[model samples]
Target: MHPIIKIESLSKKYKDAELYSLNDFSLNINEGQIFGLLGPNGAGKTTLISMLCGLVKPTSGHFTIQELNYANHASKIKKIIGVVPQEYALYPTLTARENLHYFGSMYGLKGSHLKDKVVETLDLLGLLKFADKRIETFSGGMKRRVNLIAGILHNPKVLFLDEPTVGVDVQSKNAIIDYLKFLNQNGTTIIYTSHHLAEAEDFCTQIAIVDQGKIYAQGTPSSLIASTAEARNLEEVFISLTGKNLRDAI
Candidate 1:
């Protein structure tokens, strides 16, 4: 089967920056795979993801999602991909139902169909009881769950998530992970970046370790563990490849 996402020689350099944020990155993500992009701060993971999601244009290189290139088929690509960012992309004053309705409309869904989807997703994520509550009044976990529902309401074929479980209680984190696993089981290709190595190891079918805008390793979590001497887990493998130095960057 053809890869769902194909990236080649992808590089990005912000104006006035001293070095490329992403340098000659290339990778292929297959359909139905929960692919993880693991890296420390300033590793260019966010830049890579931003370019893939069409939020930021690359200085050089090319990428295609489901055989559709961004330059020529941006609208078409947007229709098939879902993005759940680290920060909440929600209006503080809008009720859960209202927020979902607005986001669903962006995908051209309307009337009873959109309402049903919103209700179903909210219920599935255990937010049905809070459907009428304003986003600003919700707890961190509640808002995160709502944020997730908004992204998947349209049911896009490919999902891109950045730190979906960055902050939340165990219950909320488990709920999110379980829902993602369910989505994957039903055939949605998931690509995500996370600081939680243990979660990634269990959730991702394949993993890529990147630093300094380059890929250092790409393989199954188990394979990565076996390849690195004395590395018994994904975290060990990650530190082994990316190193212990702090990557503080602006």
Candidate 2:
């Protein structure tokens, strides 16, 4: 099958920055694969994801989703991909169902079709009973779940998640992961960035270890572990390639 997402010599530089945030980065994500972009803070993981999700423009180079170029098919691409950002993208004052309805409407979904999808997704994520509850009253985990539902209400062919389980409790993380796994199993290609190496090792079908805007290694979690000498797990492989130094930015 053709690659679901393709990048070629992609780079990004801020107007006043000294170096590119992403430098000549390129990778192909195949259809139905749970691809993980693993890196430390300031590793350009977020920059790359932002460009892919059409949230940021690349300074140079190009990429395509399902052979659709952003320059010409941005709107079409938007309809095919779902993004679950690290920040909670919910209206605090809106009810869960209300939030979902609004998000679905942005994707051009409405009437009974959108209503049914919103209800089904909320029910599947175990939030049906809380549908009418205001988002401000919900716990962090609950908000995260609702955020997730908002993204997938359109049933996107590709999903992009940035640190999908960063601050929540184990229960919430597990619930989110389980739901994502279910989506992947049903043919949604997933690309995510995470600091959680163990979770990525178990969840990702393919992994890329990036640091300083470049990929040092890319393979399945097991293959990556085997390729690195004396490394036993994804975390070890990560440290061995990216090092343990701090990457603080001003």
Candidate 3:
């Protein structure tokens, strides 16, 4: 079977920037795998994701999702995928239900079908009780849950998540991870980026440690851990390759 996602020699550089955000990056993500992109700040993780999601145009190279290239089939590619970004892409004044309704409509879902999907997703994320509450009234964890629901109400085939559990309580984090695992089990291909190495170790089926627009390593969690000298976990392997210097979350 063809890979769910394929990228070739992808490179990106911003205007007047001295360095490329991503350089000659290439990888294949198989269907039904939870692939993690782990790196320190400014490691080009988000740049890579944005390019794949059609949000950021690459300076060079090409990629295909579900065998549909963005150049010719952008709309079809979008229909088959979901993106949950780092920031909350939500309306602060809109109620959770209203917000989800609007998002679901973006994917061409409408009327009773959209409403049912929103209800089901909200319930699954443990946000049903607060469906009528405005986003401004919700806690960070609650907002995160709602944010997740919005991205997935259309049941996308491949999900791209950037730091899905950041800034949430442990319980909320667990809830999000559990939901993601459920999605993966039910045939969704997941490409995830996260700063939480320990969680990535436990959560990802495959991982690629990237830095300075280069891939230092890519393999299963155990394979990556075993390959790095004296590294007992993904965190150590990450530090071994990316270093410990603070990059100040750029």
Q: List residue ranges in candidate 1 displaced over 4 A.
A: none
Model 2: ten consecutive residues of lowest lDDT = 241-250
Worst 10 residues of 3 by lDDT: 241-250
Model 1 lDDT tens row, 52-161: 89999999999999999887999999999999999999999999999999999998899999999998999999999999989999989999999888888878899999
In TM-score terms, candidate 2 sits at 0.98
| Tens-digit per-residue lDDT, 139-203, candidate 2 | 99899999999999888999999888888889989999999999999989999888888999999
TM-score of each: 0.98, 0.98, 0.97
Give the local distance difference test score of model 3: 0.92
Better of 2 and 3 by TM-score: 2
- Model 1 vs. true fold: TM: 0.98
Work out how many backbone clashes candidate 3 has. Answer: 0
Runs with alpha carbons beyond 4 Å of true place in candidate 2: none
Candidate 2 backbone overlaps, count:
0
On the 0 to 100 scale, the lDDT of residue 31 in model 3 is 91
Could you give candidate 3's per-residue lDDT for residues 111-174 as a string of tens digits?
Answer: 9999888888888889899999999999999999998888888889999998999999999999
